[model samples]
Target: MDLAMLLAVAGLAQTPAPAKLPLPVELPAVANATADPTCGNRPALAERATCVVSTQAGVEGVLQAYEAVFTPQGWLVADASGNVVIYMKRKPEGGCDAFQVLAFADGEMAAPAAPAYLAFATIPRDICQAADPNAAAPAQ
Candidate 1:
């Protein structure tokens, strides 16, 4: 074969394999939480936050005092005086959930406690449903 033709064929064979690119690693979505007193009264969101706490605690003792309040369908714990002391809420749209630990010593309108927010992406509804047959499936 002609030298030019041989060189051309060799060049084609040497075309470096398409530069391999790290497979687009799809990192799992992470939930970001923050404090927001404005959400104290929101129900759905609150429950979601409390759920995150319940899941994180992974223990019954710390969560024993808190009751699952459905009005806002979140977690609530009352002090010995029977006052709502802690509140938790979730913001699915915001990709986070938050908790409000009330301060009784402080005056009536005490700001939410520090690190009051714990944000986490909502756990896939399917996970809950699959784990518990009674769990309601996420709305389509």
Candidate 2:
């Protein structure tokens, strides 16, 4: 191979593979929404990683966009408390996993008209329930 072709091949070989996100789903294309690449790659069942979504759209718009992306992929709106929306999906192993999104507008934190933050956290337990016995409960 020529020097240029060899360099290109070396660069391709060095490129890192994309991390496997915990939810294994894609975010919706909201207007002016940009995601920080270092988030939502946690593979542990109990651990949660948050991907901040910087968007010019307001809080409502962010939530709507997430709902559109998550709903069709078998995720249901489990709860919406203030700026946070919890989406739950049933696991095939007789349990549930959840994606919790917390959206904040410009005025909520930092400067005015700042980027809206969409923090996503996934948990193995259903957030709709009052308690999760398997997680916090003492073993027999």
Candidate 3:
């Protein structure tokens, strides 16, 4: 390659990558989210990523608060039960990451001691499959 071409190639290689945007974390828990020391690599419950949070808020309060927080970010309430709401958001930029957040309020059991909440989010649905594609043999 010519000298100019070689220099251009090197410059391209050294070009700083786009600034890595901070990966969004669970919201704060002062009526917000407490930082999970695990840094959000939480376990899966019912085939979705999960996290437990402690809050003094009741079901209605939590529903209202989280709706305000997530709705502006384009997440929609996919499903809701009496004390639980499941919010889901697909990557709008056309990526495979689909997050479903399950927020449950259990004040009856956890009350008088500061109610606790559970939230499951950022789950990739493709991993929860019934058939094991990698298995080469049937169970004996």
Candidate 4:
């Protein structure tokens, strides 16, 4: 290769890579909600991505809050039951990502006007499948 071409190649190799942005997993802000460390954190691929929040909205209200915020953002409701809901969305890089909410309100029974603890977790597609064999396979 020519001397100029070699120098250019070396410069390109030494150029610092662009800084990575924070993970796309974060809970939507809810009225009268605050972080609740009592639920602790769950580990993601790189770090703890689970967020436990305390709210007076109750379990049903928390579910509604998440549905309202995430549905418009392209998140699909994967599953919803009595006190738990899971939402899934296609990741920007590839595959699917899941956001799960588990509510523990007033010691198991969910009652309106009582304090509720909601655990929000972000799980990558690979981990999600490994954790549950029956889970739908991620899109290629």
Top candidate by lDDT? 2
Off by over 4 Å in 1: 1-67, 71-114, 132-140
Q: Write the per-residue lDDT of candidate 4 for residues 1-140, one digit (tens) a residue.
A: 11121111112223443332333555667765666654433222113334445444444455577678788888887876655567777666655777666555433333346555555655434434555667676799
Specify the poorest-scoring 10-residue window by lDDT in model 2. 1-10
Quality of model 4 by C-alpha lDDT:
0.51
Query: How many collisions between residues are there in candidate 2?
Result: 0
* Clash-forming residue pairs, model 1: 31-120, 31-121, 32-119, 33-119, 43-72, 45-90, 46-89, 47-73, 47-74, 70-73
User: Of 1 and 3, which scores higher on TM-score?
Assistant: 3
Q: List all candidate RMSDs to the true structure.
A: 25.3, 14.1, 19.5, 18.6
TM-scores, one per candidate: 0.17, 0.57, 0.43, 0.54
- In model 3, residue pairs whose N, Cα or C atoms come closer than 3 Å (at least 3 residues apart or on different chains), thus clashing, are 28-32, 28-33, 29-32, 29-33
Better of 2 and 4 by TM-score: 2
- Rank order (by TM-score, best first): 2, 4, 3, 1
| Predicted candidate 2 versus true structure: per-residue lDDT over 1-140, tens digit per residue | 11121111122223443433476455656765566544223223113345555543354555666678777899887876555567777767755677666554333234335454555666544554434555555569
Local distance difference test, per candidate? 0.27, 0.52, 0.42, 0.51
Query: What is the lDDT for 2 in model 1?
Result: 15
As a whole number from 0 to 100, the lDDT of residue 58 in candidate 1 is 23
Regions more than 4 Å wrong, model 4: 1-23, 40-57, 92-94, 108-111, 127-140
List, residue by residue over 41-103, the lDDT tens digit for candidate 1. Answer: 334333333212212222122223223222235423222122223333434543223233321
